[model samples]
Target: MADDSIRGISRRKFIAASGTAGALALAGCTQQNTGGGGGGDDNGSGNGSGGGSLSGEVIITGSSTVFPVSNEFAELFMDEHPDVNVTVDSTGSGGGFENNFCPGDSDINGASRPITDEEVENCESNDVTPVEFQVASDALTVAVNNEADWVDSMTFDELSQIWRDDGAQMWSDVRDDWPDEELELFGPASTSGTYDWFNENVIGEDYQHTAEHEPTEEDNLIVQGIQDSQYAMGYFGYAYYSENEDSVKAVEIREEEGDDPVAPSLDAASEGTYPLARPLFIYASEAAAEREEVAAFLEFYIENSGNDTVAEIGYVPAGDDVIEENMETLEEISG
Candidate 1:
């Protein structure tokens, strides 16, 4: 069954970005899960189910940021292997790792952050080992209202000056040419994986001024906040920003000395020009991989979908060459 723990914005944003809108008929799935023991029809379809039947259910849960990518893949996979029933749950990256990655129980888990030593221990604690798969990268895009004209890109140093508590809080505070209202900040809650990434990569882990505003795990909340205010600044994974392209504007972060500050376009993000781009992932237990359903799902997922789904979801694709390489990795590992 699905969990209603997260607010609505994340779901809506995901639906918008991932082309889940195409399957609008399949929203709000609520089938209760009994620890992923169920399987599906042995003769699943598209991409050729490899002449096998998956008789059980495959439960995947993890980072909301990673959900769209995986979910899009999952949907396509299910289309390929009719017998393979798969379910994806978005309980935040941290929640999935903490609650669902029980070695003997859950099959796969996704995380927005890299696994910690403690979490590795946690995986082993329940006898479930973890394997990392770098799926795609994302950027923590800082966006503003579309009407904003005085600024274009920002530097980490400049970001720290504007966001960390000690930095002036208003758009005008950073520059005299900008408006003089107090700086308004919106961002993910402390528990979010993106939050940690933003802290370490963007603002430094020891940022001084983060306490002045709301820290929400919901990207949609941050999106709404930013959309509603002109003086506000916020960050979320690239896909969220992409989905709301009509409502928000992505700010560029200045990089090389000769290069123009670049916004988070698919081209810039894929080529690594976007400063905040990062690899996304999911960890599957060896036991999970051993299952025909799991194997077929992953095989079909990487095969039929891959980077196409990434682009469909509004984030940059991993590129056709990268997609082929990932397929090769899966074939080698699964074989």
Candidate 2:
């Protein structure tokens, strides 16, 4: 992301930048590095409070959605271990896994969706064994403009009609009272884990697309699209919804067996009652885990992520118990 985070511009400003940015990707978005911190003192200082370096170079690339959380973790971890270089990249979840697991490039691969059998096979082909760690829970949120007040929440069936290809593209086609205007959609590419989650839930078995909303695969773009137009609708992980709530409005989603429509939130998402709720994961290769640097960084992430790091990045913490389990596992690996 750009420094505009502090400037606070309208979605229009973002779109205008998009037009000129030529294939603006949701990759490693570097901010002004806030260097200068103490080093050498891991008396369990936790989030780099004591300021000691972790000891080597660590690279992470994956879901743009996961980047913020992992980046937040990295920033804090590096503060303590400034000597260790920790890098997080968002090349889309599937892309991250392919690059890391196939070639085994990344120490950790963050994903918005669960690992596929194919991805697992790819890892095995490279003689890499992957172990998954559940970092947090997420609700796949869909948002529309605040101006469109007729609908507050929707059934999965309704959402399906709204976005799936060959399905009704107009808002009214899904709901009788909705306007006849066609709904302009925005979302990630097919390579994204978010896309797979969306298709399985929103698009039915026969779903196929003739066209798609583009150039803005990052959730921020979806936020911009919806904020720009009342008729626009898009979906992404809930963290984006929380970060862009002022500009975008969240729609309630009805789970198949649910009694009431629920809006996405940390509480609702954690319980799995939110229709679009699911777990977020990071799959790491044994080879990567063997590296002292990779081991230290991933350990730091699991620790800090459940602590202050993830929340700062607009995400909920996976419970303390889960975090403890991860830490214990890390100690086992390093010990």
Candidate 3:
């Protein structure tokens, strides 16, 4: 696909003015460059480290939620092997696979949720089989305005009630003692993997109820919405919440009445007590795996971008067992 990295921002001018940090920031954003055949390594030292003699580009697009983790991995990978260029685009998970998998334009697709059966069928029909890798775990988080002191925690049923189409629109409607304030809702778009996971787990069969909440493809917009109003509450991947902890308050979640509520955190999510945890994935096409650069980058990603990288990006690691299984899967794919 076309590189839509920075629209009017010239890469060279941006690099010259902002240095390496700005280049890395530009890497993770949606930008474009039309003057060149393909982008090259203008940010790293021209020396190869322990990484193999792999040269060429590894293009990854998908999941704005997973973009930070993969972008960190790409930054580190290019540091070791400057000759190998890596680009990560933050398209939503479904758009990522659809745009890059059938025609096989990308080496890897970063996803926040599992690939659907229909997506798998489409790739297979196009002669591309995807090898899946579980990279990290994320706790879908709900947050309210920092001033919303009346709510400390909520049960799954209560959350469903708040989000239901014909359900409560006032805080006092949810709880008799609470003030009668109009409830404002913000959330991710239907195309977002985070949205899918929440819809399946929290909204249940009444998925159409989400129409009441304002939806946007951008997580930052949701964050901003929550920050703007005391009555506002919204949900997105845990990473965004963690990054904006000071501006918003995270709502504790309980599966049922008797269950103790659990706060969203690395420990709670990894231990399965968070009540809204889900696995994150990256699917590599078998055709792309044939390229040495693609293979090397996948190996590096599975091996190095776990605990430290996940934590740095405000996500929970998938544990040693999952990482080991991922390594095995990557080996099988490249073999």
Candidate 4:
């Protein structure tokens, strides 16, 4: 994928200007570009602290919601260890686990939600033990077209009434004073963690999510669909909504009718005030973590999970305590 990292800067420039020092600090390794590719001194440190240049490939796939963070980190990590090739793909979380990750094709998988028991069983069938790491937090954002100013906040019941199958066909169906225009829905497909979370939390178990809406793994497509119509509404990760705030309006969410509506934001998510706030993660394959480059890249990722760049990319960065716990987990899994 083209480097759509922060500020539209080239990957080389981003690395030269800021990533090098940050990466070095995170990995605690000095990069020595030997004229020729040579295996680093494998001091049996398993944690990637060996001396010399690290070389190899690390493949990451999963959650479109967590893709931005993983993709950015991969670029930065690759720049620090030029001989290491890191690739991140935005396969929906379930799709990744079922196809690439559980099948042992990817070293790591990013996920917006925790893995299911079925997924764990599948991974075990392939002998891939998945190690979970919380990398960040996201406020799942429900957005509507910028021009649709009839409503700004919605209660969980109202949200359910809109998303649940055969529940609401028009805006007026949810509330009396709202517009009578037909609701144009857009959202993530069944393979997406966002879809699962939304269904379980907002739509509830009694009803099914309407299939009348457009569904895709690409969040940008949801944004585009919302942008195209005045009555369009959809939900996706907060990062996508933040990046396209001008084109769409996020709906404030109230847990119940009497509760105040909470707007989706990094602060709201971090404070646990946002109704849709959820943790984002990356699962490392235990077998792959033994590889020097994969372990090194994961170390860098965990160390920088709380960095400013995470918030800059429009999500709540992991706190110091979370990072500490994650590092311990990384060490254990890699060891």
lDDT of candidate 1 over 174-287, digit per residue (tens): 778888777778876655677667667777767754777767656777888888987778888877876676777888897544566878765666677778787777777766
Per-model TM against the reference:
0.78, 0.81, 0.83, 0.86
Best by TM-score: 4
Off by over 4 Å in 4: 1-52
Instruction: Let me know the TM-score candidate 1 reaches against the reference structure.
Output: 0.78
Q: What tens digits encode model 4's per-residue C-alpha lDDT throughout 123-233?
A: 999999999999889999999998888889999899999999999999999989999889999998888888888998899999998898998987878989999999999
Question: Which model scores highest in lDDT?
Answer: 4
lDDT of each: 0.65, 0.66, 0.72, 0.79
Task: List candidate 3 segments past 4 Å from native.
Answer: 1-52
Worst 10 residues of 1 by lDDT: 23-32
Measure candidate 4: CA RMSD: 7.5
User: How many clashes show up per model?
Assistant: 23, 5, 7, 0
lDDT tens digits by residue: candidate 2, 76-185:
56666778777766677888778755577777878888889998898888887777777877777888899988778888777777667777867889888989888888
CA lDDT of 124 in candidate 2?
88
